[model samples]
Target: MDYIFLNHTADIYICVSGETKERLFANAVLSMYDIMVEGKRRIEDIRKLKVDCINEEDALVDMLNEFLYLFYTCGFVCVECRVKVDEKLDIEASGYYFDKDKDRLKMEIKAATYEYLRIKKDDKWRANIVFDV
Candidate 1:
């Protein structure tokens, strides 16, 4: 796993890292989904996402909230993604719709928050994200 769960009293906190920024964003998405559901998802559907943000941290949070919107409103559970980070963030995501019979709901994430959110680069890109539950 590219992400690890952290201690948070009120919401979900995670430290996600990758060799590159695109990989960092992708891992963040997967980590969010990992917190919410426990099941295997097939790549039966695809969704493209775009987010315009002032900076990388905003981009990350907005992109995550977009995925959360899709999950709550359309039942899309992204299992894999291809991300491009530039003037704008673009993502091509693939996954199946959430199936009650095949998937278990582990938790509900209302949104990704800016509080305690940070993205940094050392030997690798890393992000600390907080989800509002």
Candidate 2:
């Protein structure tokens, strides 16, 4: 995964690959958070959580924002996120949160959009998301 800052505006272009859509989305969030704050990983703890958006793209943004929000507003570190897309097409993630000892993740996640979306050469998921940073 990688990120690019466009020239015209401060928006960020995020690219990620995974075997499945869920994997790609999760990897994207992990990369995004890691970029925001180096080594902001949390210890493993089991918990269940759910987040539902209007559609696939909206759901992706919602999940990403949720993780960032957890870190920013509550200083809640993410241990792991298990996602499940429901029949009605809602995204759910099970994970745990923690306290942040340092403000390592300072960059703001203004917003995300599934503008640049595609599949890779070897059959992998891809997307160039627009961040309102």
Candidate 3:
């Protein structure tokens, strides 16, 4: 599966999988955005964002946090993202302005937490991400 929702008592958890690590990271980002805003919205702007991290899990957290920062501060909602992850995380995302006052939000994701975070790459890449809501 590309991703699946997991039951969390007080927050949110998503399990993501892909044939490669890069695709897995991209899926994780998409899942986070899905929890924030509807996926059907039109994308009007494209932004290039990058992050450097100590490890795979750190890169995932930084990428999601960056999106949250942009949404909370700039009203951008990502529709599509192309992500490349190594020692550095680079993403090119197509996003549209989403006014929280006017748009429908699924939930308020406060942060992407390290608690219960896992990044595993075997035959394929898989990860579990927890978000504080």
Cα RMSD, each candidate: 0.9, 3.7, 1.7
TM-scores for every predicted model: 0.96, 0.69, 0.91
How many backbone overlaps does candidate 3 show?
A: 0
Q: Name the lDDT of candidate 3.
A: 0.85
- Identify the superior model by TM-score, candidate 1 or candidate 2: 1
Candidate No. with top lDDT: 1
Model 3 earns a TM-score of: 0.91
Q: Model 2 over residues 21-114: C-alpha lDDT tens digits?
A: 7776666666676556545444545434567745766677777777666666755555444466553223334333544554454566666655
> Residue 84's C-alpha lDDT in candidate 2?
62
Query: How close to the true structure is residue 87 of candidate 2, measured as C-alpha lDDT?
Result: 36
Instruction: Give the C-alpha miss distance for residue 132 in model 1, angstroms.
Output: 1.2
lDDT of 1 at 41: 62
- Which of 1 and 3 is ahead in lDDT? 1
TM-score, structure 2 vs. true: 0.69
Q: Rank the candidates by TM-score, best first.
A: 1, 3, 2
Residue 77 miss distance in model 2 (angstroms) = 2.7
Colliding residue pairs in candidate 2: 116-128
